[model samples]
Target: MGNARTFILMAVMTALLMGLGAMAGGSQGAILALMVAGAGNIWAWWNSDKMVLRQQGAVELSRANAPDLFDLTAALAQRAGLPMPRLYLLETDQPNAFATGRDPQNAAVAVTRGLVAAMSRDELAGVIAHELAHIRHRDTLMMTVTATMAGAIAMLGNMMMFTGGRDNRGGALGGILAMILAPLAAGLVQMAISRAREYEADRLAAEITGQPQALASALARIAQMAGRTVNIPAEKNPASAAMFIINPLHALRMDALFSTHPPTEERINRLMAMRA
Candidate 1:
């Protein structure tokens, strides 16, 4: 169901881009839009993981440096029948973790220092299992594709801002509107897709861990810390906010339209339901 929904949303986004193109130009314009969006998606597919890791200032860690963390993920990967993904550690004190890479074999999972210090063995396992579930399901790949479309939309909006409405029919007025509004709309769409995927990951995590309550508790803790603590890099690069276990943005009010994660309470409730 999550994969199906992903495809549907991607299709809708593609159609919207074409519509914007048509509005901006014509059939030729639509083709141009599709090409640009395609290229952006391809670029994101290969580079987004690296880009996000860099944004978080995560450092690749060896098993020697993080034996327990490595051992835990290795154990979980074996249980999940997945390749042992590379591990990374973030210096932040906000208890959070995220997964990246295009596929399970290529995946990397990063946990923050605070996370290791904060969660118990079971809770940490639950959290790591959740990220591995994302890897197993290829959520990173899907999100990269989604981000590409969103980035294309933002690029289109930028183009509109420059041409002074000369090339497109909207002329100066339409250009102004597209420039002002399209990126914001694209952001909302991206956020909606991200939120949906979070819910799906929560369900998948519960299945992987067989301990829904553990994940539920972890989510509560992460959410509480996310509010008070600042992930400086995430604040600098809001586009990568969806990559974290929590949104990681301290302000928390990036407009509902732009929110990438669902309300924490709802996510916890859904995870707890699996316990029942």
Candidate 2:
């Protein structure tokens, strides 16, 4: 069901982009929009992991350097029937984690300093399992594409505004409307996709670790700590904020439109129900 929703949402985003283009510059504009979105997806697919890691100042960690983390990750990967993904450590006090890569073979997982210190062995296993679930289901790729399309749509809207949609049917009013609403629409679509996958990831993580309760506890703990502590890197790159296990942003005024993750309480409740 989640997969189906992701597919539908992605299709909607693409259609929205094409519609924006048509409004801004007729049939030619629609073609250009498609080209731009395609290029953006290609770039994001190959480099988003590196870009995100770099943005967060993440450092690669080997088994030799991070014995416990490496061992745990390896064990989890074995359970998931996936290759041992690369591990990274971020220098932050926020308790959060995220997975990246275009596919399972190229996948990587990163956890913050605070996450390592905050969780117990069992809780940590559940968290790792959650990230591994993302890799296994290829949610990472879906998210990357969604983000790229959303960004492209926003850029197209900006173009319309600046150019006054001189070639468009609706002219200045259309440009103004697109400028105001395109990003918001993109964000809504993107967030919808993100929210859909998160529930499935949570369920799969519970199955992988056989410890739904542990993950629930970890989620609650992470949420608590995240609210109190500042995640500097996430703050700097708010666009990447949706990648984390928890919403790490401090200001969440536009959560309805911008929140990438589902509600923590609801997520925890679902996991708890799974145990029952």
Q: For each candidate in turn, give its C-alpha RMSD to the true structure in angstroms.
A: 2.3, 2.0
Which predicted model would earn the best lDDT? 2
Per-residue accuracy of model 1 over 168-234 as CA lDDT, tens digit each: 4677777778766776776667776778778887887788778999989998998887788887777
Error (Å) of candidate 1 at residue 124 is: 1.5
For all predicted structures, in order, the TM-scores are: 0.89, 0.92
Off by over 4 Å in 1: 1-3, 252-254
The residue ranges of model 2 lying beyond 4 angstroms of the native Cα positions read: 1-9, 167-173
Q: State the C-alpha lDDT per candidate.
A: 0.80, 0.87
